[model samples]
Target: MLIAQISDPHVRPAGQLYQGVVDSNRMFEEAIAHLHALDRRPDLVLLTGDLVDEGRSEEYAEARRLLAKLSIPYLVIPGNHDHRENFRTAFADHAYLPATGALHYCIDTHPVRIVALDSCIPGLHHGHVDAEGLAWLQRTIEADREKPTLLMLHHPPFTSGIPYMDSYRYIDTAPLEAIVRSVGNIELVLCGHVHRTMLKRWAGTVVCSCPSSTTEIALQLAPDAAPASYLGRPGCMLHLWDEAQGMVSHVSYIGKMDGPYPFA
Candidate 1:
């Protein structure tokens, strides 16, 4: 099955801009339109995190409107910018995130099982997976050991080398590592909170963090990194997987800009 993994949309209301330079809502609209235009649409659209700009009701209301236009099924977990209650309100009809108010859930999606975790620490920018969430994750993975499962969360369990961003990652990773080590069927860990794309591995599972569709974080050297912005590209990933073929992911940036293939 093919899954479209879109992360860190950071969507604001229409015509609402963040700072003087970021037209986040417009960027997200363009990206969603791109997905709708795809010839062979994805089987599912998995939004890793950052559904709203500031966890505001209006922001999520606008977000809901834009996302509702997608033709295929979609699932979203909470990011640092999302409030659990507001997120639940926006996705009230989603089976995984019931109206009961919990922002986490697990689903058996054909060949793959997906476990979505809520790592948002409410008002904090940094993230953590508390004992309850961890326990649920352990039980969830243990229940379905044969299927190739994917764990989606808002924070990476490891450092991404971009020091500024790394500081805001999951504060405690030992417990997460233990759970991942025990679950042999976990194929990948998908996350997005750093506003930049990064890939790492933990307990033999691939940990991937995709870039924000609106922009990107600068790739900076540690000592000199000093909280800065790079304004890189707007993009998303296409994840292809099956029992026979396994999981393969391709990252693509928006091609609306006229330019030559720089690498070639």
Candidate 2:
């Protein structure tokens, strides 16, 4: 199984730029084009969050239009930037985005189980997985242990070691840790909201985050670092899974650049 992950497009109502720097709409289109052009098309496209900047109905509508170009099946989750009601209203026809419940779901994809958990807290930049989401996650993972599971959510459960990002990471992680430790089948925990590629480990499972399609956050390695944002390269993550080889995840940036040739 192959999965293409796109995060935090932050698309506006009319392909408008964000903060006069990020062309989110165009970047999203380029990312989709890159996905389609891959040698092996993905089985599914998992959009982590922040599909829109403000979660407006128009933004969702616009997102729907942009996403329609992709031939692969896809699923979306709400981020701190997204409005839950708007998400439901926009994706009413989708079987996964129901009109009710916690906005969290568990999907069984044969040898692989994809669990989309809602970690967004209303009116806040940071996020957390509440008790309800935690319970659902625990039960679902406990029920299935042999299958390779990939947990997807908008907020990462661990800190990215960056100043601005670490402060806003999933606030309550004890329960999350317990759940992950008990599950044993969780191979990868995928998340967004940081707007940069990050790798971490939690409960023996690999935690990975992809860069936003629109913008990239500057990497800050020092503690007590100031909140500094960047206009770095836009990118996404591609996850390849196989029964024999296990799971492989890689990062790809969106842009045209020439590479040095050894022969030349």
Candidate 3:
């Protein structure tokens, strides 16, 4: 099974740019085209979060229009920039998303079981999964302990070295970590919101934070470096699962670039 992960397009209304610089809508279009052109098309696409910029109805409408172009099936979770109600109403056809309360859901797809948790706190930049949310997650994972599972969420449980981004890292992650440790079936934890590709090992599973589809956060490791982004090549992660190898991930950069030169 092939699963593609795209994150943080931050789509805005028509004729608008994200942060007055990146052309997010256009970038997303290019990303979708890239996915469509893949030789081995993805079986499923996991859009981690930040589906829109302002979380407005119009933006979601535009997002729906753009995402509709995808030939592959996809699922979405809310991010810090996303409004729960707006997101729920925008993608109401998903059926997987809960009609009320948190947008947490579980998918029992072939080869892997996906458990997406709602980590967004309305009107806040930080993320938290309350005790109630944690209970749901525990129950969901415990029910199917034998299946290989991928736990998806918006905010990462670990902090990126980028000081600016780490400042607002997910709060109250200990409980979530403990749950994963106890369940022992989570193969990986997928996240977005850092706008950069990051990998870490926690609770006996790999946690991967994907880069943005629009722009990339500058790789400034300095504690005092200002928060900023660059128009570097955007990308997505492709996860391949096989009975022999289990799951492996690869990053595919968007847009046409240098040739695949052969080494003599």
How many clashes does each candidate structure show, in the order listed? 0, 0, 0
What lDDT would each prediction earn against the true structure?
Answer: 0.82, 0.86, 0.92
Top-scoring candidate (TM-score): 3
Could you tell me the TM-score of candidate 2?
0.94
lDDT of prediction 2: 0.86
What root-mean-square deviation over C-alphas does model 2 reach? Answer: 1.8
Q: Top model by lDDT, which number? A: 3
How high is the lDDT of residue 123 in model 3?
90
For candidate 1, write residues 1-264 as lDDT tens digits. 888888888888677876558988777777788777776688888898888888889998889888777777888998998888888877777867856634778989567888898888878888888888889889989997888988889898887787888778798899989998996898888888877667887877888887788878888867657877756788887888877889988786764766657786
List, residue by residue over 133-165, the lDDT tens digit for candidate 3.
Answer: 999998999999889899999999997889989
TM-score for each model: 0.93, 0.94, 0.98
Task: Give lDDT: candidate 1, residue 235.
Answer: 86
Considering TM-score, which of the candidate structures 2 and 3 is the better prediction for this target? 3
Model 2: per-residue Cα lDDT at residue 1: 89
- For residue 204, give model 3's deviation from the true position in Å: 1.0
TM-score of predicted structure 3: 0.98
Task: Give the alpha carbon lDDT tens digit for every residue of 73-128 in model 2.
Answer: 88889998999989888888778765686688888955678988988888887888
Evaluated at residue 150, the lDDT of candidate 1 is 86
